[model samples]
Target: MKVVLLQDVAGHGKKGDVVNVSDGYARNVLIAKKWGLEATPKNLNDLKLRTKNEAKLAAEHLAAAREMAEAMKSWKVETAIKTGENGKVFGSVSSREIADEVKKQYDQDLDKKKIILEEPIRSLGMHEIKVKLHPQVTAILRVHVGEA
Candidate 1:
């Protein structure tokens, strides 16, 4: 029996995949558990249409990511820190702080996790930060740290 998987089946097939299984297993396990559907002509055609739509949406998301990356290259964020007489910062700046500052100052929301900081900022100066916007897109942002 030919079956179209609705979701991934361990050691079997992935979602939207067509595979041949024994008639008894297809009727008893796959269909009974709603893991897959019979690969009728209508179901096959629907799968093709869904795949096409998914590809289009993925392309649109990539384009948006690229645009955001370009915009970020020209943007700069400023953060304030408390310092002692010797100019040593009290606490290091975190990615969460940078993300919040960007949102508050630039009116754009950015994920803290996406703000890749190899090490927390401990000294006051201009720093470059890398932001992973997407799998294929990365942006470098300038950050200025000043005493408060």
Candidate 2:
């Protein structure tokens, strides 16, 4: 018996996959448990259409991420830090501060979690920050840190 999996079944197949199993198992374990549906002609066609729509939506999301990365290259955010005598830095700059500064300066809302910071900025200079816009897209944002 052929079954279309509604969810992943260990050692069997992933969701949306069609797998062949014994008729007894398909009828008792899969259908009875509501884990899968019988692979009828209508069910197969619906799965095919759903897959096609998902692929199209994924491509559109990737394109939007690429476009945002291109636009972010020219954006610069200004931030400030407190410095002591002899030019000693008092505090470091964080991703949350950078995100807030970008919104305040450029009117662009950016998520702090998307800003990748290996460590907090401790120096006073222009720094390049990596922002993960998507799984496959990364953008560089310039941040100019000066004394407050």
Candidate 3:
């Protein structure tokens, strides 16, 4: 029996893929679980239209992410940390703090996970940070650390 997968199935096929399986398996495992549908003419047409719509949405989202990355490259984030003599901070700055500053400066929300920090910043100076905006896009963050 031929089936159209509505979602990805590990070790089998991905969403929108048409695969062949035993009649009993399709009926019991896939159809009964609402994971796939029988590959009828109408179902095939629906899958085609769905995939086209998804592709269009993905393209638009990618374009927006690219614009955000470009804007972020030239941006600066200023942070005031508690410092002792010789411009040394009492504590380090984490990715979460960086994410909050990005939002405060540019009004753009960023996930803390997207900020790639090797470790917390412990010194006082200007440092460059790496931010992953998308799988295909990246941004450089300029951090200016000063005494509070």
Candidate 4:
């Protein structure tokens, strides 16, 4: 019997995949557990339409990410850090601080986890930060550190 999987089934196939299984197994396990549906003509057509819509949505997300990356190149976020006597830095500026500064300055919300900071900023100057907007898109964000 042919079945259209609603979710991944180990040793069988992934979601939206059509796989042939024993009639008893399809009726008892897949259909009973709601893991899959009978691969009738209507179900197959519905799956095709859903797949097409998902592809179009994915393409739109990629385009938006690319546009954001380009705009971020020209943006500069300013943040402050405490400085001690004799030009010594008191604390470091982390990814969370950078994300907050960007939101405060540019009114753009950014995820701290997406801000790739190998080490905290410890100096007072301009630095280039790498922001991962999407799997295929990375943006360089300029950050200026000043003494608070």
The number of the candidate with the highest TM-score is: 3
Which candidate ranks first by lDDT, i.e. highest? 2
lDDT of 3 by residue, 75-140 (tens): 989987899877757998899998999899889999999999999988888999998888888889
Spell out the clash pairs found in candidate 3. Answer: none
> For model 4, where is the 10-residue window of minimal lDDT?
100-109
Q: What is the C-alpha RMSD of each candidate to the true structure, in Å?
A: 1.6, 1.9, 1.3, 1.5
Give TM-scores for every candidate, taking all chains together and pairing residue i with residue i: 0.90, 0.87, 0.93, 0.91
lDDT of 2 by residue, 1-148 (tens): 9999989999999989999999999999999999999999999999899989999999998999899899899988889999999889998999999999989988888899999999999999999999998899999999999999
Where does candidate 3 stray beyond 4 Å? none
Give the candidate order by descending TM-score: 3, 4, 1, 2
Candidate 3 scores a C-alpha RMSD against the true structure in Å of: 1.3
lDDT of 3: 0.90
TM-score for candidate 1, residues paired by index: 0.90
lDDT of each: 0.93, 0.95, 0.90, 0.94
* Candidates sorted by lDDT, best first: 2, 4, 1, 3
Candidate 4 overall lDDT versus native: 0.94
- C-alpha lDDT (0 to 100) for residue 10 of candidate 4: 100
